[model samples]
Target: MDVQSGLPRCSRHPDVETGIRCTRCEQPVCPSCMIPASVGFQCPDCVRGGSGTGHAPGANQPRTLVGGRLRTDGRAVTKVLMAVNLALFLAVHTAGDRLVDRLDLIGHAYYPVLGEVVGVAEGEWYRLFTSMFLHQDLVHFLFNMMGLWVIGGIVEPELGRGRFAALSLLSGLSGSALVYLLAPPNQPSLGASGMVYGLLGAWAVLARYRRSDMRPVVVFLGLNLLITFTRPDISWEAHVGGLVAGVLLTAAMVYAPRARRELVQYGACALVLLSVLGMVLVRTAVLL
Candidate 1:
């Protein structure tokens, strides 16, 4: 049993908790890192060792670090997310400020295009979700898409498609919720920076889990945080909120007990989502 986690950590992935051991080698193995054997489950190394005489190697299904089934193409969900962002960018370019007015995250603002008040405070709650995909500027779109491509590539493969998507959307929603609660009611914000920052937080958590050096990621995060605070027109609340949500969500995922991994992981996400909804309700009531 790991002294810190109080559970037997997987020998292959030290971050994962497990209750089982390989019959052949007696090394702890998580569900993903072990293969079913005749007598009992075997670790991958033992399965490959085969009969101890090196006669032939045994085959086994590949799994991600978190026990998710491996995919032929790990970046499929990332690609889809990018495509959706790109499509929305093009739509915003064509539709001009009108579409942005409709979708951007705002507390309460009167839009000439709609000839009425709008925003999350006005019961247009979908803006919290849609604003994440709406980038009105070319540079903003490019920067966010690049971040998504780079960070999502690493996180998606390990977390699998569904969990990765959930982390991203929930993080983005958390950012929007913060913006709604803190930013000026009429000051609108729209972009994927929240999601990008969330993924960055996920990356940092993953690196620490593997016992890798922390200096580089710490420096990178610090630089981004510096820019967030110093830069003009940046939504610092969104970045900070997404970072916190990502760290909590990923911790729940990577540290969950092997027996109840999926339930705990998804349940953590749902809890974050519920918290965001509560924020929206409170903020809306105050605005009204």
Candidate 2:
């Protein structure tokens, strides 16, 4: 109760008046303290308490903001991803351009070693995924790995390991699809830029959802966009595609109806992949 106005105050915020009560503890919670749960809005304390500490086994467990299970090692998935990218970079350095040509994202190109035309249009669809881990040089590899370390570390805990991995791959694939559809058939592209940009977009969305200051993210994104367009070497298509996909995917995860959250989130991911496949097929047909 508030001594000033004689009205009930939120447990978390003494100055804020609120009539809404948490579904679990029956404690009054202000709008800022309310978190959407499977049944109804709950306070942060109740959500944290339900994390399998003293609660009975099989009791309705708490979920993350995006419906993922809470984890202690939030950056576990990020480390693995970075390792994969680093391993692939080493392999490319050892094997040289032949390996790069074989693994890089290309629409269609003639390889002298094979003495024939090959590319995604010729059914090398795996390139779309493999190319994500390839990099041009030491600088490129370091830059992308650092980004994964930071952004993936932030997003993985919130979305869980599986969901975060799925988002990264799908976002990269979206970028590859755009490059395939728009770039010259013989042109080649590779890097984790798409995936990094995707994670960046997800970070922005998360910040917005939490009602945090948006200026920092907005300014950073703007700077990146400026660099993407100004630099001749950058693949704007990949950056733009990944950014768009990340925004949409994160939105679906965070804003889905609490009644069927997992279904809606994973379903959105599937739809994005299907859309990418459709784009690939159409582009392949045109190339062929």
Candidate 3:
């Protein structure tokens, strides 16, 4: 029993004399105690009763969130957003054409008093957000909202509520800002097309980031971009602005290292918003 200062054999297999340590419990073990895993090996005892028995046990197993009806992640920001859009749609109808005239974005509104009240005139900016919720006609409204529901379903879970809301609002503002700068003044425009296009841009980029199949996204963007160029009476300028905002904002969110992810992402968002305002101010100075 004393071959090279033979110690007592394994606790479980005394006849087998070998020296190997359990990765988890760190007890002396023979070859028999080793359990193979994807990365290195575990001890028989550790494998039998999960990985961590010392601290908070089975902490990772349970689902933390039960997303929306479609998404089981325990979060329903997308659903809430859709509901809000629908409510606004109803409100727009209830308010009648007068509301559209007031809410729809334009480079300039003739009614300075109304514009001032709603932030649509000089130094007024509420139209940037309000316009995104308005629609010139029923068909236009449905088309844009359909795009929102489809894309929001895909993108929301990935970004979560806070970031999703930020993206939509900023993208919508950027769209209206561009329209204000480029489109003819006093010509009103409405609908969420700009925001929808922005979502498409961001979705395509994010899909590429995950190394997923990007053919469908690419095709969808191509078709929509084509339509934007061909369509008459459409503010194509807004589409361009929203697309640029979405792509850049998403890039900031996706590429940030894990060490300071939230800090960098939200910071980027704030900077983008400030840049939009800066652009608007410069445009206002030039026009007025």
Candidate 4:
């Protein structure tokens, strides 16, 4: 009896045929060789590649499942991020002042008592996360979300959701932190611009790390930075901080040892988050 037809033989284990394809590399794998992951099955080789998969020779191997679902073979995460931003924009507009006020209360607001941190100086510190969900106005929201839609669509599918999420959260927090540290005492800031900038930075780094042509990223980043500095109402602090942090964090993750890169990336993000929190605390103390 040919077992290969009944159960796909594990590419790694000749004796074992579990009929499972690695969600990452799509290599036939046995249950014993299959490694369970947050998104889906990942073989040992794919797991070891980490963010460096695109650079690996065989990394392009077809994926059977991703994030525990049948592969759509499209930029699902990018589409979702864009949809969320658009939906939130409509909600904020439709809800009007009521939504803004509510978001201000729970979202990141300029609070002298809380200083520059997202939720740290105030009980609503959760705003660090929530603020990313809110936008200052329609134009502001649309522009930032559009950037995310474009850059995220390009990067998320390549980097995967976990890395993309980390980039978004860290960039958002970093942007907030910059505003907290550098903005006027009573000034308040909110938007997804910081995260968008972070995505730009990440893509720039990814291009270099993967040795891909970076002309597009460089052109885009340069144009945005120019706009950021020239625009009077723009939160330049958030843009600068998030961009810098994104670059640094991406560098740390890209250059670090593969076995330890994820840990380092998480640690780097945590440190930035804490730094933002600390800035808020100091500001609160100074005001008090």
Per-prediction TM-score, please? 0.81, 0.82, 0.72, 0.68
| Model 3 superposed RMSD (Cα) | 9.6
Q: What is the lDDT of residue 181 in candidate 1?
A: 91
Model 4 spans > 4 angstroms off: 1-74, 105-120
Candidate 4, pairs of clashing residues: 39-67, 39-68, 114-121, 116-180, 119-125
lDDT of 3 by residue, 233-260 (tens): 8889888888888888788777876457
Query: lDDT score, residue 146, model 3?
Result: 84
What tens-digit string does per-residue lDDT give for candidate 1 at 1-288?
636758788887889999897655556889998788654587877777544332233324444666565577989989998999999999988888888888899899888778999989888999999999999889989989998999999899878878898889988999999999999899999999899889989989998998889898899889999999999999998998889898998889899986798899979998999999998998999999
Clashing pairs in 3: 65-73, 65-74, 66-73, 66-74, 67-72, 67-73, 67-74, 67-75
lDDT of 4 by residue, 193-264 (tens): 888888898889888988999898889999999999997878888788788778877777667654575677
**Quality of model 3 by C-alpha lDDT:** 0.71
- The weakest ten consecutive residues by lDDT in model 3 span 60-69
Which portions of model 1 show Cα errors greater than 4 Å?
A: 1-61
Alpha-carbon local distance difference test for all models: 0.85, 0.85, 0.71, 0.68
